[model samples]
Target: MNATDRTPADLLRSALAADPARPLVTFYDDATGERVELSVATFANWVAKTANLLQGELSAEPGDRLALLLPAHWQTAVWLLACSSVGVTAEIGGDPAGADLVVAGPDRLDEGLACSGERIALSLAPLGRRFPAAPAGYADYAVEVPSQGDRFAPFVPVDPDSRALVVDGVELTEAQLVERARADAEALGLGPGARLLSGRPYDSWEGVSAGLYAPLAAGGSVVLCRNLDLLDADGLAKRVESERVTRTAE
Candidate 1:
C-alpha cells in the first residue's frame, strides 16, 4: 500500500483496501455478446481463488513460468494477476513447451497439451465454464477454481526484483512492472478514480499497460473491450460516455 510497494498483487490489494466497492474491470466481448463488471472485491476474490488453485493444486512457486495462452478477456486478466499473487511469472503468448504451467483458452487446447508441466483449460464462456468434459491430460479451470479458497497466501515470499512478466520479447521484474505501469498511467494521463476504455489487445506492452497494469497503478478502473473493431466510432463514443470513461486507449 505504500509508495514502495511494487508487486502487482500487492498493488491490487491496496486498491481493494482503498475502495473495495469501486468498479475495477468492466469487460465487453462484442464478438460473444457478453458484458461483465467486477468490483475490486469481486476481482480480488477471483484472483485469490485462482491463486489458490495455482499454488495449492499445482504447487506453483516463485519465479515459475506460467504460459498464458489467452486473449484479451476478463478471465485472462484474472490469470495474470493470479500469477502475480503466487509469484509465478506470467508469460503472455509464450511457448508452452518451456513453461512450468500453461493456462489456455478454448482455441489453444491442442497446443496446451504439449506443455511440460501442469495444464489448465478455460472455456472462456460467459461465466468461465469448463469444457463439456475435461480435456485430456488437463485440469478444468472453471471446475477446479471455484473449489479453491477465497483467500490465498504464498508458500514463499515473492521477490520484487524477480521476473514477473514477459511480453513482446521483454521480461520485467515485479518492481519494474509496477514502475512501467505507473509511468504508462502518467503517460496516458490517468489519475485517481479515472476510468479507461481500452480496445487494445493484450499481446503487446502498450495494450497490457492500458488494459490492466496502468489502471491498477493509477488507482483507476478499466473498461476492456474485445472485438472493438466491430463497433462503429459513434457506438464506441457512446459506450465511453455511458461508462463514464475518463480516458481511452485504442
Candidate 2:
C-alpha cells in the first residue's frame, strides 16, 4: 500500500495508478463453474458507478449507516469500496431497522425490508443480472447502477477519521480500517504481486480482511471463491495452479 494512503479508497486509487491493467479481483463460484477476472480499472469503474448511485440516487451522506447484507462475491467487494468512497459506514450483517440504507441480495430481501430508508436489491446472478421484477419497496441495483456515470466524485469529501465500517460489532474509522488492513496484510505475508485465494465468507472481520482488504492493501490481488467446499482436493489443487495463487485463506 502507498505510505500516503489514508483510506481504503486511497489504497484502491494507488493500485489503479500503479497498474490499471493488472488483475485485482478474480472470483469463482465452484458450484456453478463460473469464473470472472477484473482488472484494477474495470473494478474501479464498477466502484465509481456504484458510488454514484449511493451518493446521487440514494442520497447517502457521510456518516450514514448502510446495512450490507450480501454474500462473498465480486459485487460485494465492489459495494465495500463504493461505501468507502462515499464515506458511508458499512455494517455487515447489521440490523436493517437502524440503517440509513440497506443493500441486500435476493435471499435477504425480506430482512432488508426492515430498513425504512433507501433499499437496493441485487440479483447476484451469474453476470450481475437484474431481478425479473423489482422487489417491493426496493430499487434494482443491477438496473440502476449501469446508468450512473462511470466516474464518481462525492459532493462532500470523506473524512479519514470518520466511521467507515462496522463488522462483527466492531466499528472502525477509515484510517483505522486502512491501518488494520495493512497490518493484516503483513500478518498474512501478502506483499506486492502476491495472489491470495480466499474461501472465507463475509460474516466476520477476519473474512472481510482476508477476502478483500488485505490483498488490496498489500498491492496484491485475491481469488475469491464461493462454495469452495464443494471442490474436491484435486480440483482445488488444480485451481490453485491455474490461478497462480500464492497463498490460501480458509
Candidate 3:
C-alpha cells in the first residue's frame, strides 16, 4: 500500500478486505469470560455511522472538542477512530465536566452523573432502549443514538497542517504527526490484520497519535488496555494467546 494514500480510515478498509470474516474485535467483558466478537467491516460501519450521528444530531463540526470517556476496550477504539476519520477533535478525559460529549464507562456512570455540573454527561449501555434520561443537568448518551444510521456523510476537509490536537496549550497538526508516524510504521512493515495490544496511557497526544492512530494508519489494529491489573494473569494470558497480538509499544 502506498503510504501517501493512506488515512486512519484505511485501516478498517484494508482489514475488511483481507480479513472481513475474521474476528477483528474480540472483547472479554468480565472474569466470567463472556466474549463478544465484531468483524472489521461491521465495526467500520458502526464507526462511520457513529461519526455521522455526531455530526448530524449533535452538530459536531470539524475540530470540535469531544471528550471520550469509555472503559470498554473495543468501544474506545471505535470512538477514537471514528473521531479521527470524521475529522472531529477529541480529548480523552475521565471527568466529563468540560467536554461536549461524554461516553462514560459503566462503572463511572453514577459518579459521572453526580459530578457533572453543567456538563452533558451520559451512560452508554447496549442493554436497553436509549430513552433520554434527564439526570439533573446532563443528557443521556443513549445507545440508540449511535444506532440511527450506517452511513457517514463524509469526512470534513481540514488542512493537513491544521491544529488537530492540543495538550497543555501545546498544539500540533494531525497531518504533520500522523504522516510522520505512518511513514515509520510502513518502514517497519506493520500492516493489515496485525493485532497490536498496547499498554499505554492515552491521556497524552503522543499515545493517541503514535500509540493508537499510527498503527491504524499502517493498517494494523491497536488494542488498548488501560488497566491490565484487574484481569487475572491467566485471563490476560488467554486473551493474548487467542488474539495473537503481535506487537506492543510503550
In TM-score terms, which candidate is top? 2
Per-residue lDDT for 107-214 in model 1, tens only?
998998778899999988997777899888888998998888998889898889999999999899999999999999999999889999999999998999999999
Q: Which candidate would rank higher by lDDT, 1 or 3?
A: 1
User: Per-model C-alpha lDDT, please?
Assistant: 0.92, 0.95, 0.58
What's the C-alpha lDDT at position 2 in model 2? 79
- Cα error, residue 243 of model 2, in Å, equals 0.4
**Model 2 — TM-score against the truth?**
0.99
Candidate no. 1 TM-score: 0.98
Cα TM-score per model: 0.98, 0.99, 0.72
Model 2 residue pairs with clashes: none
Better of 1 and 2 by TM-score: 2
Write the residue-wise lDDT of candidate 3 on 1-250 in tens digits.
3445434555556656666676555544453334455676777877877677666666666766666655435666677666666666656663456655555555555555534332333443343235355555445545445555776655466445544554434455656556755765665456765676655555665556444565666666655555555677796677688778776544
Better of 2 and 3 by TM-score: 2
Order of candidate numbers by TM-score, starting with the best:
2, 1, 3
Error of 3 at 136 (Å): 4.0
Error of 3 at 61 (Å): 0.9
